[model samples]
Target: MRKIYVVGIGAGDPDHLTLQAAKAIGRTNVFFLLDKGEAKASLVELRERLIKHYGHPHKRIVEGRDPDRDRTPADYTGTVADWRHRRSLVLEELITEHLGDAEIGSILVWGDPSLYDSTIAILEEILERGAVDFEFEVVPGISSVSALAAKHRVGLNRVGQPFQITTGRRLAEGWPEGVDDVVVMLDAQHAFTKHPEADIYWGAYVSTPDELLACGPVAEVADEIVATRTEARERHGWIMDTYLLRRNR
Candidate 1:
């Protein structure tokens, strides 16, 4: 039987790699990568950098073209399901072609494997189809949410209170029920603009050299964030951001 390790490589900083994740990389025989295209080349470069630093000298690196999906779909859940299915197919093919018996393969996931990432789901989907056989494990890494909170020097929730982690689309719909602290990710729509009453601790490319941080009352800082996001996106061709919305209740 073959083995796969889904290792989390942290948000963006190289130093974010945990000792356990590094050990897993050192043990891997092959590194599977999905290229998200030219605009996101920096992401691919980061993965390669880690592999070169910690991977075995003769470790094989394989690449697969990531399936493209609609950024804004009327049916979000259905669209994501389809996209994930397509991605699973691509990964399944790569595994079958490149991964040898008894050899260890790895998928270096950004942030953490369990948070908002599709790699694990894709693997499970492939297994469910009975097309592949491999044992796998997840090595957790620092998430952008954690990095954002650390950079802002704030806690996610106040004393004795709970918090919610959600997407920008869900936040756009409305604030979640019963949660004064909301963490938002993947908000391409500038959804924070909808809640001018909340205080936002926002950061883009957290833990990276290009990191940007802003915080204040939404009414006061929303415009600044939007402008900064626009400029950064235009300059870099892509952006990954997360924010904590703390409402006064």
Candidate 2:
């Protein structure tokens, strides 16, 4: 039987790689890299840099692409189902080719595997098919939300209050009904513009030397975030950003 280790590399910084994640990388015989096409090539480069920095010689790197699909549709659930199906196919193909007998393979995920990541979903699909006998291990890394909070020197939630983490697409569709605090990720449309009540603390490329941060009332700085995000993305060729929004009562 083989094992697949899904290790979070954290957000764009080699130091963010946890000790356990580092060990997992070193132990794995093969490493699979997911390419999000040309728009996010920097992400692929960042992962490569971390691998080289750790000097892990036993690992062989293989590249894979996320399934191309129309993710924005009237039926969001159906769209995601199709996308997952495609991803599962790609992962299965990669595993069959590179995973030798008695070897462990690792996929370097961005941020923590538990947060808004689809690697596990793809793994589940592979498991459903019973194509390969394997066990999955998740090595957690510091999430961008934690990094954002740390950079701003603030807690993610207020005393006795709970916070919700969601994607920008959901936020744009509507505020999460009753959540007091929301942390948004993968927001390409600047969905903060939809809400006026919350205070926003936004950071782009948190923990990296080129990190950019902006914080203020949603109404006050929403445009700034949109403009900044656009300019930065244009300049850097890629951006992995996360933000926290607190609804003040």
Candidate 3:
């Protein structure tokens, strides 16, 4: 049987690549890439750099256009589902045409596969359609959440307490019930601004050369974060950020 490795490459930092992920890259027969256009060209470059350093000498790299999606949709869940389905079809074709029997192909993910990434789900959808046959393994990498906490030198949860990881959309809706510590990702709207009373540990492009970090009571630093994030996004054309919000008990 052919094999597919969903390898997490870490959040924008070459150093974050783990030993297992390196081995997977070195063993890969093919690497599939989805181009997100020039606005995020650095991301594609990072993948290329890793493949060059650790991948097999004769590894073939294939490219596919990443399916576009609505950033702001009236029906968020439905829109995302449709987008994922489209992406699954794209990747299905890539695997069917490129991957040969008894060879290994890989999809290098930004963060851990178990996080917000859709590669795993896309693979599953392809299998469900009965169009592909391959066994896959997920190689975990450091997540931005973990990187944020580490960069800030802080723990995720309080003693004997649990922390919740949520998207900025849900955080904008409202804080989760009964959790003092909340980690937020994909927060395009700067949802942390809503909870001015809470303390925040925030980092943009964590573990990368262009990393930016800020922390303080939201009331004091919300404007600063917004300004920094906006400026950075304008300068880089994209930004990936995560933050932890701690509420005083």
Per-candidate local distance difference test:
0.95, 0.86, 0.95
Q: How high a TM-score does candidate 2 get?
A: 0.92
Error of 3 at 44 (Å): 0.6
Superposed by TM-score, candidate 3 places the C-alpha of residue 105 at a distance from the truth, in angstroms, of: 0.2
- Highest lDDT against the true fold, candidate: 1
Better of 1 and 2 by TM-score: 1
TM per model? 0.98, 0.92, 0.98
Kindly list the per-residue Cα lDDT of model 3 for residues 138-188, writing each as its tens digit.
999999988899999999999999999999999999999989999999899
Q: Could you tally the backbone clashes for each prediction? A: 0, 0, 0
lDDT per residue (tens digit) for residues 70-147 in model 2 = 745798789888888888888899999889888899889988999888889889889999887688899999988999
lDDT value, residue 21 of candidate 1: 100
lDDT of 1: 0.95
Indicate the worst ten consecutive residues by lDDT in candidate 3: 123-132
Error of 2 at 196 (Å): 2.9
Inter-residue clash pairs, candidate 1: none
**Sort order, lDDT high to low:** 1, 3, 2
lDDT of 1 at 167: 95
